[model samples]
Target: MKKKKGDKTMKNLKKKLMYSIAVSTLLLGTTIGVFASWSGQINVQPPGWGGSVVSWSGVTKTSNSSKFAISGIKESNSLDPYAQLVNSNAAAKSSWCAIRQGQTTSVNDNTGVANYIYYTRCKTNNLEPNSNIISYSFNPY
Candidate 1:
């Protein structure tokens, strides 16, 4: 029994339509899967295995006669870190060195008190270790 030409053409068209639908579905699924796994935060860790500053509570100032206290948190403390204080009027620097990580520590005023105090968060350069400051504020108090 010979099949009619119109019936054969219709079957071919249906097969092509089914193939197109399957390919389209596969591509759409792939695109959606790729977008679903994205994370919003950038990695700022300094070539190490730890995360960047989780939170900063800001600098606090306290004064008692000639002595002053400046304190804050450096949550991801990986190296030699300090809370540094500078008096702009008197040209003096007071640094509280080797503070325990994630703890509130005070940098005392070794020199006489000045009109303004500049607080800085700094760490020793991992490569040089004792050479220079890794991070500090340009402005002083």
Candidate 2:
């Protein structure tokens, strides 16, 4: 077959396009992986005078390796705060307690996959009426 004048140019252009696309895809994947994170807050108020309250927040992260920090404030000192990281099946993967005011409590799960996190506040030794407003923020990476 006789070689056409534009055939070589067209072949070169096609190769360049494919290479550009491959490089773009690799860069996009790396960017997303490096800057992926999720954060939220939860508030719980117990109805009774001496019971516990629990609230849950969910995330879309799919990695088995995860780290999270939870911090919160309580209206009363009698209420103790707790945080937990759970998997997609609602199983407890890791848990932390004694979340103090103005401080953060963190948990790192390298082997257990997590999809949800929850916070709890339990009233202890306080016979007074329950008028506690507990709020917690969850940050996961």
Candidate 3:
């Protein structure tokens, strides 16, 4: 028997509802999956690989005689593949630091640092490396 007009309309509405539900389910699943994957990728990062902060510890002081400490995890090591880059940079900038008494230039600067002598981390542009949050403590004398 031929379907009534009302039945046809009801059938169309049901089909539309089914399609809508399917699309919504797919979208919701995708969103959740993406968030889970991205969260993991963003949380813990390795050297040269971008990641979120894991942890931090450090210290600061206005005076050189004061005690201080800085800690952070870098994307890469300054000694990796860039040893020469670090050395060259150190040579270029050793002259600026007046760390030594009566030392005008960095002639005895065997530390192989550019612009600054920093262990565990250094940069040619003097930019602070991104890492996990940190805490610091020290004595001034």
Most lDDT-accurate candidate: 2
Instruction: Give lDDT tens digits, candidate 3, residues 12-127.
Output: 99999999999999999877643432101111222332221221121121223312222222223232111111121223312222111122111222333222222212222223
What is candidate 1's lDDT per residue for 10-116, written digit by digit as tens?
A: 99999999999999999998776444322121212233222112112222222233333323333243454443444433234564444343343444444533333
Q: Mind sharing the TM-score for model 1?
A: 0.33
TM-score of each: 0.33, 0.49, 0.31
Candidate numbers, best lDDT first, in rank order: 2, 1, 3
Better of 2 and 3 by lDDT: 2
| Candidate 1 collision pairs | 116-141
Clash counts for all predictions = 1, 0, 9
Q: For model 3, give the 10-residue run with minimal summed lDDT.
A: 79-88
lDDT of 2 at 44: 64
Model 1 bad stretches (over 4 Å): 1-72, 89-91, 112-115, 125-141
Best-to-worst TM-score order:
2, 1, 3
